[model samples]
Target: MNSEEVIALAEQGILTILLVAGPLLAIALGIGLIVSILQATTQIQEQTLAFIPKIVAVLLGIVVLAPWMINHMVQFATEIFANLTKFVG
Candidate 1:
């Protein structure tokens, strides 16, 4: 493939990664921020205190978003596969 095609493929790969991971990451970030605030206010300095909630939040986010995530991934894969000849030639 030419440079442009390579770049386009790279871009699509990155976009797919972000689309798949963004929600779970955002949920974890939000949960971590809230837990940090609560810890600050309550003076609970246990580092592990934030871990469980963040894990649960990420898991819940994944569970809730699994179908959508899978659909997006499948669509991306389909697009790539549909263009397989172009990529190969």
Candidate 2:
């Protein structure tokens, strides 16, 4: 493919990755921030305290967002595959 086509594909790939991962990452970050604030206020610096909440939040986020994530990925894949002949030539 030409440079423009390659760039477009790369941009789409990156956007897809961001769309799929953004929610879980945001959930983890928000949980971590809240935990850190709580730790600072209460002086409870348990190593697992920060981690467990973030893990749980991310897992829950994934569970809740799975369908949307899958839809986005499938759409991206479908677009790429549909244009396969154009790319091949």
Candidate 3:
């Protein structure tokens, strides 16, 4: 493929990745921030205290978002595979 075509494909891949990951990452970030505040206030100083909640929140967000994420990924993969000849040739 030409440089423009390759760049377009790369951009598409990046956008797909961001779209798929943004929600879960945002959830984890927000939860982590909250946990940090809580720890600072309580002076508990437990690393796992923040870690577990962030992990669980991220997991739950993933579970809730799985269908949409899968659909986006499947669509991207299908388009890439279907256009394989165009990309290769």
Candidate 4:
């Protein structure tokens, strides 16, 4: 592919990644921040306190968002496959 085509593909790939990951990342960040604040206030300082909640939140988020994430990925994959010939030649 030419440079312009490569750049376009790269941009699309990044946007797709961000779209898929944005929600989970945001949820994790929020959970982590809240846990940190609570720990600071209570002086617990337990490592697992922060880590476990974020992990649980991420897992729950994944479970809840699985369908949307799958749909987005499938759509992107389908588009790429449909455009394969153009990309190759």
Q: Judge candidate 1 against the unseen true structure and give its global Cα lDDT, from 0 to 1.
A: 0.95
For 1-89, candidate 1 gives per-residue lDDT tens digits of 89998998999999999999998999999999999999999999999999999999999998899999999999999999999999999
Q: Give lDDT tens digits, candidate 4, residues 1-89.
A: 79998899889999999999999999999999999999899999888878888999999999999999999999999989999998999
Alpha-carbon TM-score of each model against the true structure = 0.96, 0.96, 0.94, 0.94
Model 1 root mean square deviation, Cα atoms: 0.7
Minimal lDDT window, size 10, model 2 = 45-54
Cα displacement (Å) at residue 85, model 1: 1.0
Angstrom error of the Cα, residue 70, model 1: value is 0.3
Candidate 3, run of 10 with poorest lDDT: 46-55
Q: In model 2, where do residues sit more than 4 Å from their true spots?
A: none
Candidates 2 and 4 compared by TM-score, better number: 2
Better of 1 and 3 by TM-score: 1
- List lDDT for all candidates, in order: 0.95, 0.94, 0.94, 0.94
Tell me the spans in candidate 3 whose CA falls farther than 4 Å from its real position.
none
* Candidate 1 displacement at residue 28 in angstroms: 0.3
Which ten residues in a row are the worst by lDDT in model 1? 54-63
